[model samples]
Structure formats: C-alpha cells, structure tokens
Target: MSAKRICIEKDKKTSDDDKVQKVVINSLDYDSLAQIFMLLPVPERIDIEGVCVKWKEACQLSCLPKEINEIHLFFESLLDQKQTRSMRMHGSSYEASRELSAEVLYTIFCTCKNLKHLDIVHCRNDVAEIPLEKWISFQNLQYLAISCNMTPDLADTIVKYCKNLKHLRINNRHHIINTALKTLTELENLECLILLNCIKLNKESIIAISNNCKKLKRLEISIRSIYDPPSSLSDLDEISKLQYLEHLKLCIGKSLKDSTIIAIANNCKNLKSLEIAGCSAITETALVALTKLDNLQKLDVSFLHITDSFISKLKGLKELHCDFCEQLTEAGFIQLIKNNPDLKEISVLGTDSITIDLVIAADQATKHRTNGIILHIRKYDLELTQAFKSIIKSQWLVVK
Candidate 1:
C-alpha cells in the first residue's frame, strides 16, 4: 500500500471517533438528562450517582419529582466493603455499609435541598444526641416519620424550624409527655398526626393540640398504657373545636361517652372515617348520635358496648367493624345488611352469635346490590358446613 493511502485511512477513522464522542456528549441538555435520571428506579438512580462526576451532579439537581423528595434513612448496614470504598472515592460520605451517623445525615440533608419528607426508622437511641439545631437548615420539610424517642427540645426545634410540616407520624414507645405536645401546638398548619403507642399522652396534651392546630384534618392516637384514666373523654370537648377534621382514630382506653360521640357528630360534620376501638363506655345512644353524621363512611366500634339494634341505624356506613361485640346476634346482623345496602365491608369477628346461615343470608342480600361484599366473621362459623368452608376458600368469597 502507498504511504498517502495509509495516512488518509487513519485520518478518516480518527474523524469518525470524534464525531461519535461529540454526539453522545451533546445529545441531551442538562434538564433533559436530570428528568431521565428522575424517571429511573431508586437503585438505578443510585447507580448513576457513581457513574461519573456529571451523573452525580445531575442527581443533585432539583428537577426530580416531589414524590422522590422522601428520604428513608435505614440504620442497618446494607453496603459491602467494596461499595463503601467506591462511595468514598466519589467524595460521598453517605455510606450504606456502616451505621448512619449525625454528620452523614446532615450531608444527606444538604445534598437533598428540596427534601420535603423524611423517615428515620430503626435508628439507634443515640440519634437523639444529634443537635436539633442541625435540622433547622432543613426548613422545607413538610412530612417527617420517626420511630425514635424524640425529646421535648427536639420536638420544639422541629415545630420551630419545620413550619411547613403538614404530616407527622411518631411511633415512639417511650413516654411522650405533654411538654412535647405543647411544643407541637405551635404548628398551626399541621394537618395529619399519627401517634402510635405513645404511653404518656394525656388529655392536657391532646387539648393543647386541638386548641392550637385547628387545621388538622386527620388524626390517629393510640395510647398503650392500661392504668391511664379515660380523661381523654373530657378532651373531646377540645377536639370538637376542630370542625375541619375529616378522619379520626381514637384507640384509647374506655373513656369515650355518648356526649363525646354527639359532640363529634355535631361539630365535625366533615368526618368521613371514625375508629373508636376499645371505647367500652360507648353504647347504643352514641350510635344514634353517629347516625346523624351523613358523611360517615367507615365506623370501627370494636370492643365497645354495641348491639344489633345500634348497628341497624348506621345509614351511610360503608365499612363497619364491630369485632368482639358479643351482643351482635344473627337476626340483627341480617337486618344490618338489609338496612345499609351501601355497606361494603363488615367485621363481626369474635361474635359467638353470628352463624353460617346468617352470613349466607347477608351475602345473598348484598351480592346483587353491589359487585361483592366483604364479611369478616368468626373462623369457627365456617366449620359448621363444608359448603361454607368451600365458599370461604374460593376467591369468589372474600372473608377475613
């Protein structure tokens, strides 16, 4: 081959390589690249963080959807030694291999500037040691779910800094006293609050929340202590002030009375779902008051003093849970199904009087009205007949 021919061929090959590289680099603009990254699954997006400097920078951009603003910090080590080394090489201290430290959490908060929701679960008790002042920087946080024991000071800091917070779920098994709840009263814009197994929650704290956070729409409070008096009933007067409340679940001790239910029905007319489980003080009178609530769709009177007569009056009830109500009889159960044609789900578990025949009658009555119905009766009821057992096993029948 001639020298000129060989040189020309080499130049042509080099020119083609340059064109390919340029096309790949300039194919998508910065915003387009960030949008594509946002569409990727969590694991794939994390993978892109280690691809190169450009990808890691793209991941930090605010072009991602608001749904992805949530960050779940898991305490358990999930990364291998090799992965940890790679993260360090990329200058990222957010290690998945070791237990999350306060410094690492702060780094995450800084990187995710647009972070609105954060869930810190299965974290060590030492997490409380992290200064609340550090969290002041994350002022845009709108929702926070923490399983750790939060101190009054920390709670105060959260209410002070996270002014835009709308939803909060604190599953602290430790004693959460009134001081922390009083601090929460400062959050006037708070909408949804879920307090599960908070041992020290009392009437005073509940009243503070009710008086201050009038904008609250949904609330779920479950007190775990056995000795705490039913003082929460008196606090219901305070809760009655929240006319904007739509959904409420009170799984406290037997303090609720007819007046309490009447107060809720009269004031919170917007209430659509209500769960008063373990309120043994409630009776038929309360049910009569509840019947006035035209918007009430779901009712949970489990472990309460309710009978078949009271169940018949719930006109708009779509879901009724009367588990462990021994007074409910088969005749009344059938009457209930006939009366509330809109009823979609019914739970009569632990009721000894509900027989297989009654369930069959109830099912037949509602089957044609709607596509289907869900009945959660006692398991022993199914043992009376094989036909009933087969019906339960088949997908056609929905039982729990």
Candidate 2:
C-alpha cells in the first residue's frame, strides 16, 4: 500500500487521549517517523506531503536502508538494446518518474548513501548545473550518465574525487571543450565514455581523448562540424591510437569519410560492435571496408545510403540495423537472412520493402536456427500488429 493509505489506516487505531501525541506523529518528527518507518513491514513510496514527507526526510537522516543503489530517470536504451519506448516510467520504490531537481537529487544522495549507478538522461534543464559537492556523499558512485552542461567545477570535482567512476555518459552538453577534456585525462582508469549530442566535438578534443584515454574500450560520440570539426578526410586518424578499443560509434552526419572507416578497421582491429549513422559523405565502400573488421558482430548504419552489393558483401554479422536505408530492398535482406545462420536481430524500420511476406520469408529461413532471429519494424497497423505480436516486436520509430 502507499504511504498515504498507511497513514489513513493507522489513524483509525489512535486513541483520543493521544491527540497531542498524534500531532508529533502526524507532523512526522524526525526521530518518531524514522522509528515508525522501521517498524512497518513494507511501506511503499513515501513520495507525499503529509507525515510521509517526514518519513522521507527521516530516511535522509537515518540512511539505514542502503538497498537502493541504482536510479534510472528518463532513461532508455541508447541504441539496439530496447527500441520499444522513448520514455520509461522508472525510479526507486516508485514506478512513476519525478522531477530530477536539485532538491530531489539531494534527498536521494543523502538517503541512498551507497548509490552506485545513476542515469538522468532526458532530465529537465531548468535547474542550475548540479553542484558536485553533494555527489561526495555517494561513497560507491561508479556509473553516472547525465544530460547537463559541463562546467569547470563539475570537471574539477570529477578529476579530483570521482576515482571509482568507470562508465560516464554526458549528453547534449555544449561545453565539452579541450579544457574540460584535459581535466578528464586525470581519470586514467575510465573505461567507457559515451558523449551523445555533444555539439563541440572537434579535432583537438577528439585527439585529446584518443591520445590520453588509451585504456578506453567503448566510445560513442556525435561529431558536430558546425562546432568546429576538421573538413579534411584524414582528420579522424587519431581514433586509431586506442588499440584496446572494441566498440566504437561515430555520429558524424555528413563529415564521415571512407578513409576514416578504413583507418579504424586497420588500427582498431579488435572492434566488435560498430555503429555509424547519417554519414552521407562516404560511399558504399565504407560498408565494404567494415567487412575487414573480422570481429565485428553488431552494426547500425541507420539513415545511411547502401546498395544490395554492399549488403551482400557484409558477412558474419550477428546484428544489423539498417533503418531508413532506402536502397535496402526486401530481396537483399532476405538473402542476408538466409546466409548468416547465426544472425540475431535485424531492424528495417522506414524501409518500403518490408511487409508481411518478408516476415514470413525470414521466419521460414531461420526455422532451423538454434536461437530465434528477432525482426523489428514500425507499428503500422494495430490488427496486423496484433496478428504477429508474438513474431514481430512492433517498435515505433517516432516516439511520443
């Protein structure tokens, strides 16, 4: 039951002589509320304004139940994990989402002293940049993915104290300049770095990461040339410095070229998963060159131009996402489905060639497979969707 309902139920048993005593209980005195809260077997979310407000406030003071060590707010699969919904109603002890304000965050930081992983992607930007001083309370803070502007204070605090931080994702920040990156160089143990929609990704900044973060294994960053990226084809060779790099995704719209892909294939030989979308500058040769990555398993070339020849050339790929590839016809993908027996997933959203017939064809081709192949497509018809709900997981490309 909710904390509010608990209060109402507890009210019926209170004695009339305990009226003043009940005021102390109703007002939610810190010590009294904490004691009462501990007595309850399983009190639900204390997200309320009444005595439960004191219950939450008391949780901040007591810091007893450090069970909740993770918080996911406005979070979804970055790509290829779960494409069903854009927004997830997720939180701790509460399934509904709440405003990720400084006060709410402070309460969480103070309450869950051992919070290890926090993902606040798609949070409101109205609040001021989060004060990193409050973050010191998290003794076990490791994975932090947030959408906020990077400031000197934020960078300095991260460089100084956040030693255990492993996976860090900063999205839609315009201040990821060379200075901020220089501070991050202090985090030598950093393994995974994902910079989504960072408008200031440039040659110098990219070089700083490639030159310093040699231990990096996964890197996903968007290249915005309007924010000062190099125009030449060979400007991205610095990416080859990370010999340990396994998974790499570059969101360069029109600036990505074939030479850059070739360099990554030649240098980052251990690359297993590679995703490049909106790279209109390169030819189908880029897809053909990716065939050189022997370890490549997952590939996402969404919103790119590719023909039947390149699609046929790519072999041994386990997962492929070719959403909006106008030239990727039904015959081309079915051939791919029949060839790669170990193929796991294939997304053809926004492709005109996909139909019920193609779905039947793919199912028939993979009938002898050990593990089933999941097909992803747009939610075009409700009746049709209901008909194949078990076979096809209908994911809407345009999320609400």
Candidate 3:
C-alpha cells in the first residue's frame, strides 16, 4: 500500500478509539457516577464538575444523601478561592478578608439545604455575616455547634432562622451573659443545649431556658473558670422545671451538692443519663439522691467521694465511670459489679483502690454472661503478670 494511504488509515483508527472511550465513559449510570464523585475527597469532588460536560451535569444532579447531615468547616480554610490584589495586599486580618471568607461559607450554607447538623466552630466571621433575608431558612437544621465569641445578635439570628433546631452547643471561651441566652428561649423545640465555658450564664438565663424550652431532654452546662461565682443549688432550681429532661451533665466548679441532685431526682423522673464528673462537693448524700433515677443507664461520678454502697443501689446501670474515685475499694468495686449484672462498661482508671486481682475476678465472674463487659483500669508497667496482661490483650479490659 502507498505511504499516504497508511497515514490516512492511522488517523482514522485514532478517531475510532477516542469515540469508543467516550461511549464507555458515558455508559455509566447516574447513580454510579454520583457515588464515585461523592467518594472523592472534598477538593477532588469540587473539581469533578470541570472534568467534562457530562460529568459536570452529573455532579449537579447528584443530590447529597439526607444522612450526610453534618457539615464541619472547623479546621479547613474558608478562603480557598484566589484573593484579589487588594485582599492580598491587606492580608487576612482585615475585615474585608474575613467578610470574603464569610461569603464563601454563606454560599456553602445556601447550597446545603438538607443539612440537619452544622458545626462552624472557630470560623473567622460571625454567623450573622450570612444575611438571613437573602438566604433560605435552615428549616431542617436540628444540631448547630459553634465555638467562638458569641454575641446576643448571633444567638437571635440562630433562633430566628433555625426554627427546628433541637440540639445547640456553644463552647465560647469568652463570657456569654444572661441576655445572650434569653434569645435561645425562643427555640421552643430545643431538646438538647450544651454551654461550655460561658461563665456569665447566670440563674436568670437558666430560668428563661427552662420556662420557654419546655421540650429540653438533654442539658449540659460546664463552668470551667473559678473567677465566676459558683452556681448554688438555689440557682439551679430552674432546671427542675424541665420535667422531660432525661440526660443531664453538670461540670460546675465544685458547686454540685446533695440538694441539687435531690431536686433533679424529684423533678426529672425520666432521667436516664447523669454526669456529675468533677463535682468534688458531692458525697454519699448525692448518691442517695441519684438512686431515685431508676431508669438511669449511664452515670459518670468521677472524682466524687462515693462508696461501693452507692454503686450497689444502681442495679440497672449499664455504663459507669468512677475514675479518680479514691474512696472505691477493691471489694466494693467487685461487689458493685456482681450486683449490677446489667453493667456493660466500667471505668476505674484513676482509683487507688482497684487491684489486678479485682479485675481478673470480675472478668472471670462475668465471662459466663452472654454479652461481655469492658473494664477500663489504671495503666500498669511492663512488669504486669502474664495472666492479667492476657486479659487486657483479649480486648475484655482496657488499661489507661
């Protein structure tokens, strides 16, 4: 054959191969293509739209699953796009730069209408940067977790827009006064509210929340600073009004007393999970008060001065953490375990009383039971006995 003829045939073959490749790529089903795109890393997923016209169309059609509820922008840089010459010259510290970042986040929120949980912890700009009037309301937003300097305006914006918000977590290092909390009372459907390091959250705010958010089922308030006055039992009386409260975690600065626990037990009969960890003021009297919560499933009384008798009363307890409890003895611990057969996990890591023998004995006693138990014990050196080490290796025990 002639050389010119061969060259023409080679070009024809190349064109045919390209056509076959395009046909194969386009043959993939929409769902399969969407799943493939969803499996890619966030940056790659965003870039997928630019791959080809077909891929771009598929990417747009791919609605994120409803179960993909959580949106975490905490660690990631909000300013991913290229900055203008002016923004670059001024640097990110400027208000304009932060506002630009906020706009990018606002775009993200606008896109994710199906998001039930949104966590924008440590995001540069305040949530208010996203104009409520222009954007669609987050009706499905149930859980909102923000860790920043909270203003009353931000609280009002959240309560105003996120009407269905059930769980709200605020971990602000700066003081959030009572007036800021008053805005949250408007969230009538609010079931769980967690306030950590908000020192200025006073009795009035607590009362406001109790009175308005009657549907609250879980409440966690942790006051880490001693500079703020301790919340007395009388101040916590407002919590009793939340009759439906089931899970309560109070890590106040040595303010939890017998009366506080008694009030909770008397009012919140539906209590299932109770955590009073680091409440050093609590003693046997508080434990007696806790016994009233017959349905209590999880209990964390770490660093409290409670005895074995306290554990014995919680017969239905499933998970218990008694770390750093110096008062709990080996016999008492063993007796507590034997009494609470329903116990699935127990942590006694910082206790000075628990011995290797007690752990081994408990394991042996409970091994016969159908569902096994997990015991978290204090860390020991390499010199630990082979028999005890074997138990740890078996995943039945955790040493830490």
What's the lDDT for all of these models?
0.69, 0.66, 0.69
TM-score of 2: 0.74
Return the TM-score for each candidate structure. Answer: 0.71, 0.74, 0.72
Model 1 residue 272 lDDT score: 93
lDDT of 2 by residue, 1-400 (tens): 9999988878865655488786766776565665655554332323322234444555433323546667766433343322211112224322113334444555555666677777666656422255667666665778877776676567777777677778888875455655676677567778898987755655667777888888889998775663453464365778888888989998877767788887888888889899887777768876687888888888888888897777777777888888889888878877887776667677666777666666667657655555644444443545555765456332311111
Tens digits of per-residue lDDT, candidate 1, 66-126, equal 3346655443346554353222211211223223344445455445556677766544434
Backbone clash total, candidate 3? 0
Weakest lDDT window of 10 consecutive positions for candidate 1:
86-95
Q: Looking at model 3, which ten-residue stretch has the lowest summed lDDT?
A: 84-93
> Poorest 10 consecutive residues of model 2 by lDDT?
81-90
Clashing residue pairs for model 3: none
Across residues 1-400, which tens digit of lDDT does each residue of candidate 3 receive?
Answer: 9999999999999999999988887899655676666676545555675677557545533433433556554232445443211122111111122222443455446665766777665566666556655335476888887776666776777777788999998877677756778988889889999888755566677678778989999999888544336544466667878889889998985666667778888889999999998888777876787778778889998888888777767777888888888878888878777777667777776666656778677776566665666655443433443446666433455544
Candidate 1 wrong stretches, greater than 4 Å? 1-68, 73-106, 225-233, 370-386, 389-397
